[model samples]
Target: MKLVLACTAVVLLLSAVELARPMRRRKNSIAQIYRAANITPVPEQILQVNFGGIKVTPGLEVAPEDAVDLPTIGFDFIPGCYYTFLAYNSNYSISFLSPSIVGLYVNLNGDMLADSSAIATWLGPSPSPGTGINRYILNVYKQSGLIDTTDEQLLSYQIDRLRFPIDDFVATYGLSGPVAGTFFLSQYPVFASEDCL
Candidate 1:
């Protein structure tokens, strides 16, 4: 009778242990953003633009990823959304990066590298060598409509300014956009052989 009771006690203990099994809670905060619906409600990806403390010299092939804090996961963007990134070298009398005003890359897809509906490629910063601390004025504007965007670009071209061309670019284009971020990096003279591919 004592053996049967001991066996019953062991069974009960095993059942209790099984019932007390541990379960891990989920940690994905944005996982529940999507649900079963006609129009899938996708969460907006937050974009963070930053220059990774890289000193850019003359004729450097500085990719956009270098400007980004994290290259593996660069600027977060949404498809079908239009965005424009503009940069100006405040140290220079004229901007070699953006020869024209308000358009480093205009009407570009927020997610992709190229401007699908564009006539040219992205113009990067080309601060003249020996310049000290060129404050690159960077801005990102969300296009509300294509017509106004085109109008703004044309209006920006009409403005003729020797200094603070970025100001004219902003005012003419009605940029009124939030400055995504800014960087102050120097460009010094380096030998042709010193260039990095």
Candidate 2:
């Protein structure tokens, strides 16, 4: 009986370790992907991004059109504090390691239900042919206070929304705590581009 009990205990211990492996791998994978892309560090809170009637998890492959509409960003907001939702494409340029901004929307009143401020309108992923997987990151930044933006500036942003320096923008707006974020992968249809072949 003693030997049988000892074997059972060992089996349970091994089973617990096995179950924990995936969770640890998941955490590491999230960080690894974010770091690899050279985007801002991964936020502590992970936002749930639902696109095209499906949840867009990290590293999930998606077609460009599947992300034509804005994904539903799910996160718990802190009342009285402002937040900014920005989408970035880390592989937009043909040159290696070039990144650009795809969208920018600010929740001035700290409410997602109302019409939020859209500094730069949403432009879905349109990676050029032959460019491999492009990582589209949706970052939720908690602002220190109300952000000031002029109509002329907003118009200019729409005109030129590429090669955005994310760090500079964060400092300019006093943005803190990407409080939450999520990212997905998208690529152009290689088959459609015979020239790319």
Candidate 3:
């Protein structure tokens, strides 16, 4: 009986050792890489703003001839952070400048209804007004390949449902009083390969 108990203890110890071996190796490999590469974590930034009473700028192509000017009543976002905008009782639009690809998602009321990879193209020349805004909710992200502009089919998919989030955005922004009647977005180039106008 004593011999059997001793053998059982030894077996348990060996099993435990085997199970820990892989974890130990992984830890050591991670440590060696960290030391060799001298990696550092980047801090993230968040941006939020509230604009009241903005005007709509009319152009030959985009806005209506008699469109009224609007104000930005409520705005908040951190460029690199995961962010979402909600609006109510209003339409929303956004335009991306050179090199920055914009992925659009829209939720009607409180329900998510649409997501697209391409809302508009701003590659070669800037639009007539040089900026874009809509009276709607606009969610922005800074990840690559989130909006694919290379394929025609995919681009159509994005544009077709691009206006999904307008209502919720208007409500949220309008709660603070009447909004500027337009939600404007301005984007700049992140790389030399990208150019706007």
- TM-score of each candidate structure, all chains considered together: 0.43, 0.75, 0.23
Clashing pairs in 1: none
Clashing pairs in 2: none
Give all candidates' CA lDDT scores. 0.42, 0.77, 0.31
Q: Output the worst ten-in-a-row residue range by lDDT, candidate 3.
A: 39-48
**lDDT winner between candidates 1 and 3:** 1
Best by lDDT: 2
Q: Write the per-residue lDDT of candidate 3 for residues 65-184, one digit (tens) a residue.
A: 222222122233223322222222122224322122223322112112132222332221122343343222223222222233465643453444333343353343232212111222
Clashes of each: 0, 0, 40
- lDDT, candidate 2, 57-76, per-residue tens: 76788888888886677787
When 1 and 3 are scored with TM-score, the better candidate is 1
Order the numbered candidates by lDDT, best leading.
2, 1, 3
lDDT of 2 at 82: 85
CA displacement after TM-score superposition, residue 127 of candidate 1 (Å)? 3.2
Stronger candidate by TM-score (1 vs 2): 2
Which lDDT value does model 2 have at 158?
A: 70
**Candidate 2: TM-score?**
0.75
Clash count in backbone of candidate 1:
0
List per-candidate RMSD values in Å.
Answer: 13.8, 5.1, 19.1
Measure candidate 1: CA RMSD: 13.8
| Residue 190 of model 2, lDDT score | 64
Q: What does the lDDT read for residue 186 in candidate 3?
A: 33
